[model samples]
Target: MQQVFVFLILACVSSPGTPKSVDVDTDDDVLTGLEKKTLELETQIAGLKTEICALEMKMKEERDSNQNQLKGVSANVSDTMKVVGDHTAALATLRLDIDSLIQSVNSPPPTPAPTDVSVCPGDDWVEHNGHCILFSSESVTWNTAKVRCMYYGAHLMVVDTEELNTFLKIRLRAPDGNSHYVGGIDFGQANWIWDSTNTEIGYTDWRISQPSNGRTEHCLVVCSGSTCQWNDVDCYGNKKYICQKAAVHG
Candidate 1:
């Protein structure tokens, strides 16, 4: 363009007079070229901005998807726990019903007992009504009576029902014939516990105002002698005791 313009200028300089309009046309062309370059740059900038906006939206959607998955996992875990709890409760009710049916036919009805629903490691000490008796004669201290129960095949008796109490009264055969030493108490623990294995079972028959320790008592003893009073005496004392022998069930 410069060569062409210079050639035209020379041709004009050689002519009689040059035209002034040519200069104005050359300035207008330069302005038009600059405007085109600026417009192209603006288009490219707009395209980049659109791509950035799309990337941000994709990242947000992924985050939301992950959070929803975590929520589903949590809900599944809660449902599983609820199912286990329900089954456990149902099983307990079933055992109670069966025990009651068995007792009805057996005159001198067996007592209602809290489910020994568990398969305790030793001999399964069955509870009639609420009372359970041991069948051994292991010599132990006031405290030892409860301990040996776990080792030899029995737990200190824990009577949960009234029929169990009467049966125990007849079975213990105590010299005094009152409430005698039984296996129940935490002695030094926070809660009321059975002497044998310190079972923390909640339900029990404390003979109103008995087990007065407020958590201070450490042993359980029943009196079957003529006195018929239950007390928590020292565990070291030795006394003549009887264990319940199993009844023959047809």
Candidate 2:
């Protein structure tokens, strides 16, 4: 009976001590799961780092491109401003040159030589080139002036050449400020002819808008200023005249 009791006690105590190998296997499984999770996390972190590096490189490239564009725009604006400044300066210089040219144009010309009185017929006559010219003081109509010149054995002055016209303009600088009658007359048909020579005057110095073709403007007269341009006026209107004759040769 004592031996039977001892066997029962041994059977109760010999239950495998709570399975130490199963515990060891469970611990190994947990360590393997933890290692797998750690490996996955490390892979994810490495991918993120690569993505971040790529993003950083793209941002740097874009920034460099924007800076280059800004520099190009700035350079273009600077060049445009320089061109504008140069144009403004050139315009200013051109204006000054125009003003100087206008002043020079308005100034009077130099005086010519004295009249050769030896070739003229009388004290009132002046010799130039080959002609004797007389400036009349009395104002008269075109027909009356021609008649008076004919009585003096002369004709109304004819400006046949540039030299003769220039001579007359220089000599006609009398301070009386009177515009003188010439021999030019357009006989109601727009065809101008010198009455004395019955021909076209070869040289002409008309005013800017002379020969306005007014109803009665048929006679020509030298203007009153230093610029001795010609103008057509009414033949009936009275004006001082110039007479011309061939110079006497000794």
All-Cα superposition RMSD per candidate: 25.7, 17.1
In candidate 2, stretches whose alpha carbon ends up further than 4 angstroms from where it belongs are 1-118, 174-177
Per-residue error for 110 in candidate 2, Å, reads 43
Q: Estimate each model's TM-score.
A: 0.36, 0.50
lDDT of 1 by residue, 8-33 (tens): 99987887544457777887898898
lDDT string for model 2 (70-136, tens) is: 9999999999999999999999999999999998899887687666543777899887777888999
Which 10 residues in a row give candidate 2 its minimum summed lDDT? 169-178
> Which prediction has the highest TM-score against the true structure?
2
**Model 1's TM-score against the true structure:** 0.36
